[model samples]
Target: MSRHSEIKKTVLRGVYEDNAGIPRSTHGKRQSKFAADSQEPVHSSRYPGKAVLVAVLGLVALLGFNLRLVTVDVAGPAAMQVVEEQPLPSYRVQLPVPVSPVGALIPGNDQLVSPEPIQSLDDATITSGRYDTMLTRLGMPMADLFNLQVQTIVIDPGHGGIDPGATGHLGLKEKDVVLDIAKRLRDKLAVTGKYRVLLTREGDRKVFLKERVAFAKENRADLFISTHVNSLPPGAGSLNYVETYYFGPHTDQRSLELAEKENRDSDYAMGDFREVIARIGDTLKTEESKQLANSIHKHLYNNMKRRNRGLIDAGAKTGPFMVLLGVEVPSVLIEVSCISNKAEEARLSTPEYRDRIADYLKTGIVDYLEERAHRRTIEGGIIQNVAKQER
Candidate 1:
């Protein structure tokens, strides 16, 4: 080949081909062309490996960035999803957050606060101790507590207003007589200033039996005394007597009958009242009332000088009388005297006789209080011992 042709061939080969073949004249020509064209020439010797290294590094960086995005997409977006059904093996996907530890729970603001890292509900056992503590703190009233000296008493007057209870043939009503007696009783009780006495009716207003009981409960009255007059069946002599009644779950028939009659209004006959009484009869079935009745019965008989019916042995019965059922306190009904009998009713209408009854009741109340004070002294000792042991 001619030298010029050989040089051209070598130049073309050096321009396009890798460092496999080369000639001095061709290399010079290439360098001269590059210089004249004002183009920067690359040093191929160092560039190829560098290019490969850069490509490999760039590929690795792209792969790492894509992996990071994928991980975030998998974990970050579904954190708040609720698990509606129990997780089965197939469905048990790992959550981003792990279950919180039980040790994280600490009391805050008088309540338990979870201290452990919270991830799920499966971490700790729920406790009822908080509720139990609250209930323990909410105990009985200070008045009923033996350590406290507060005493509560409730006074109930039988019949009022339109219900002219037990109208004797002499035109005297048991309602008026009982009210007069109640006022006098209140006055006498007030003079002592030791008992907290509440009257069921302050005026000639007719309060329902339930209302009387509720009044006692709302005030947390310790003792409930309902004053009324008695009525005897036909052919019985016009004898004067005082009767006391207490209520229980299943009281004597005579006790039920007496409570029913005394509670009856003029508008309703005995039959109608009995039906009304039947529905509520079971309410007073608790055994506590029997003790209450016994206490009142014992005091009344022991204090009063009048004809004693000797407790009537009614044995703490229950009936549907509004006044007795549902009264939380110890309750008793006092039939001071018979208003149905003409002579007895006439005497009840007199203020002097009413005052006499009031005086006798006041004495009974004092005796009951004295007994209660003694009992409370004993109970107080027991309670202190129990509290110390509990602590």
Candidate 2:
């Protein structure tokens, strides 16, 4: 080849070519046209290695791109492309920490909650990334914690407004009696100013079971107290007793009946509600509630039995009442006195008797709190000893 042709060949070889030997030009740039000759660039398909090299180079360039964006077209018959890839935002999923208007959860290792605990079925958070929660590494509440203090309480007066609950014994309305007892209990707790107390209803007004639960959950109640009067079949022999309940599967037919009655007007679908309740039943919430029930029932029966000799100790029982559902803390429903029993109804009607019930409730609460504090002390000591050992 002549010197000029050699120069031309060298320049043509430097030009970027695709698999088809098509030279791609930069904008506003023109290639030097040469006479048609045998030295013209051959199709890369003729040299399979050249075509492979071109594809490899395209992939390499795509990877080295600053944006790291790419679109591969392996089977589309289209060339590989660079695309602006957007990634989804990453977030940290955190479980809710309890807070209340009356008292925020104080920073402590003790993670105590109420006896009537309810967990939200819809509290799921979708997130990506490493979140550092030791207790809830598996999206479960810390069952080992003992609350350091009982600060906020929600008192629920069952049956209000048009729903008069059980109305059979001596014309004494459950709505009125429970409300009265709740108010008196609220007053008793408030007088000490040691606890932040709130009532679900102040007067005879309609409040749905869900509403009561929402109120407690919203307020981040440490303890939830639901006051209700129990009723037996009208002819069922004078069953006068004081019973307390925590969230659990009903233990008896009577308990199931009570749960059905209390669950009236609750909007939750039975299937979904039972599923959620069953899930919660196996967790710390249920266990804590049982503890609270035992405490309150002990106090009520121990103190009240002496005052009223005929008072039956129905004992602390388990029932799946709607009012107790979704409390998200230690909570209990107290059947202070059976409304079906004319004798118990007569006692519940008096102001003095209601005041006494409030006092008993307060004692139960205070006792539970003291027990909680003592537990915190013991747990704290254990943790400290473990740390020291590690050191």
Candidate 3:
């Protein structure tokens, strides 16, 4: 009994101390409310715990529902509005574009435009003038011109077919006369075993001067020789002459005059005027050409006939001769003899006389080869011997 009483007294003392700071009336009210609540709380129902858990679950569900909602934006610009919800572009392409007008493909003036205006014959003067101006521009001459090792030789018999070269007296056609002579020369040259010769026309056929030059170039001819017969008034006495022509400039004025006369076909053919002038000018300055002409003339004069006109330095002559202009190789027009003279024409018609002329030409060619070979040997250089064979 005493122990129970002591325990109760301790409990009462602690409760009194806890409520010591509170007002007496409030402490009495709390104690009375707790006593009433303690009387009913003998067993816990757990209903309040269940309700609090339900409230917490409801708040979590609300937050989750708000987070799942999607957001959309109205954008500016039609192009932007069409974009998807991605970070990368949907298309890429490469396109070819037309080129704008650029600088002139031709050198010099820069303002040259594409689809340029069509130039009339007169309007094209500037184009031609440009070529003329190139003369003063100065550049290295063609290296092949100085290179002596060219291997091909093309020979053109002046007239053939409908276009008979020079008509001779005594019912002799110029075409037939020159063809016979060319054949003889070809045969003689073939015997030397030096060149592989090509005739522009093998038989009676008209070959344009342009076509002749083209043939030579196509064959890569190192030399081009056009053979023809000359004509003059009566009483000129049977005369035979061998002349060598280069592009331009005469060692003597007479030589120049002869070249000009021989090249007069250029005017009839309407050849390139500017190119003709330039080529002639350039030929005139070449020392090798003068030597070549003299060498050929010398051989013909000595072997063929003492009266053979010696190498006449035909000065640089200008002509529209189509064949001459087209040739990229050393070229010459050989006017063998005057067919107008009765004696010479009679001689030309004979196979024996033609063979003789061929023999003389062969000798001259041999001389030329021998001299060129010696020069090359002395220079310790290669000699590119042009080759011409008959047939």
Candidate 4:
């Protein structure tokens, strides 16, 4: 071959042949033509796959960027989610301590002697009504009415100090009115020398419901009487009456409302009342309390009516009073008068009227004790006969 032709073939081989042995003569010629037409020189390399790889990488990056934009646009804003907060746990309520006069010890001379053993009686002749009638007709020797002699009585004046309960339109506080009556009652009972009387609080001070119960129990009281004055809403001016309550489930809405109001004075939260009521229902003296309440209501109504002709008969009621709960003896709460009424408030403010209330309450207490004694006497006789038969 000619030297010129050999040199030309060598140059062509360098430009067209790739390292991988692929022919790129046509691509090289097109690149050379493009370089000639443009101002810049064309670059040719043996590794043509590198250029293709770089172009493919650029295209993949652009496609990934576009896909990311599309994904962001399609997703938009996320839906707002709401999560409810959980309720906090309930805590126990703590009550305050009470301040009151300490109980006094009874003297040995004040104690009564035990009764003599009863003579054997025939059971065949004993019927409920006939036995009672015989005792009444024959005038049987009256022994002590109770298994034990009644001595101490506790009179609790409901609400005091910070708790000025059930304020009347004329600024008469239930605490003050009930305290005054309670003092009168205590004085009257004390003067008799037949019974020892104690007051839960002698002065105006805050006394917790549980504290009052504790005071009565600590004193070994035979009977518990809580005094309170009733009040109505401003709209219920005409609804004036006196009511008595014993510890039990409330019968009416009015009784329930009164209980709720009376129970509100404690430092403890009212939410605990449901638990308190449940507990009190199991521990109350149902029949004994009811009887005491009836007696007190009867005497109180009759006595008050004598002075005030239009006095209402607000019948004996059962309510879940916190103050009356946990009392060991027969317990009753008296709503002495409706202080909400203009006329009744005026009457209740008088010393003479309050003294009358105290007298009626004392009478009721005496009546209950007498009836209890009579029942115990008959029971004692029956028990003696049974003992003789057993022997």
Best by lDDT: 2
TM-score of each: 0.53, 0.63, 0.52, 0.60
Per residue, candidate 3 scores C-alpha lDDT tens digits across 1-391 of 6999997995685354333312121011122344645665343321223344345435543554232211111111232434444432311111111132221111111111112232232322222213323222212123322435635667788878877766676878778877887887877777667788878889998776667877887887866767777665466545444454544434465454444455554444233445555544432122333334444444444454543343222222222345565675556665666677676677778888777766666665555555545433422211111000000
Candidate 4 regions with alpha-carbon error over 4 angstroms: 1-146, 266-284
Clashing pairs in 1: 104-115, 104-116, 105-115, 209-322, 248-317, 249-285, 251-317, 251-318
Model 3 weakest 10-residue run by lDDT: 382-391
| lDDT of every model, 2 decimals | 0.52, 0.64, 0.48, 0.63
Please write out the lDDT profile of model 1 over residues 1-391, one tens digit for every residue: 9999997995774343222111111111133444555557744331123344346435644654221110001111122132124321111111121133211111110111212232233322111222222122222223443245537778888888787677776878888888888888888998888877779898888887767777888988877888887776756636555566655332556565765565554334445545544433222122224334444444454444344432232222344454664565556777777765666666677788788788877766665455445544543433333333323
Model 4, position 209, has a per-residue lDDT of: 86
In terms of lDDT, model 4 sits at: 0.63
Candidate 1 vs candidate 3, lDDT winner: 1
- In model 4, which residue pairs have backbone atoms overlapping below 3 Å? 145-373
Number of backbone-clashing residue pairs for each candidate, in the order shown: 8, 10, 23, 1
Candidate 2 accuracy as TM-score: 0.63
Which is the leading candidate under TM-score? Answer: 2
Off by over 4 Å in 3: 1-148, 234-242, 249-275, 283-288, 306-320, 381-391
Local error of candidate 4 at 152, Å? Answer: 1.2
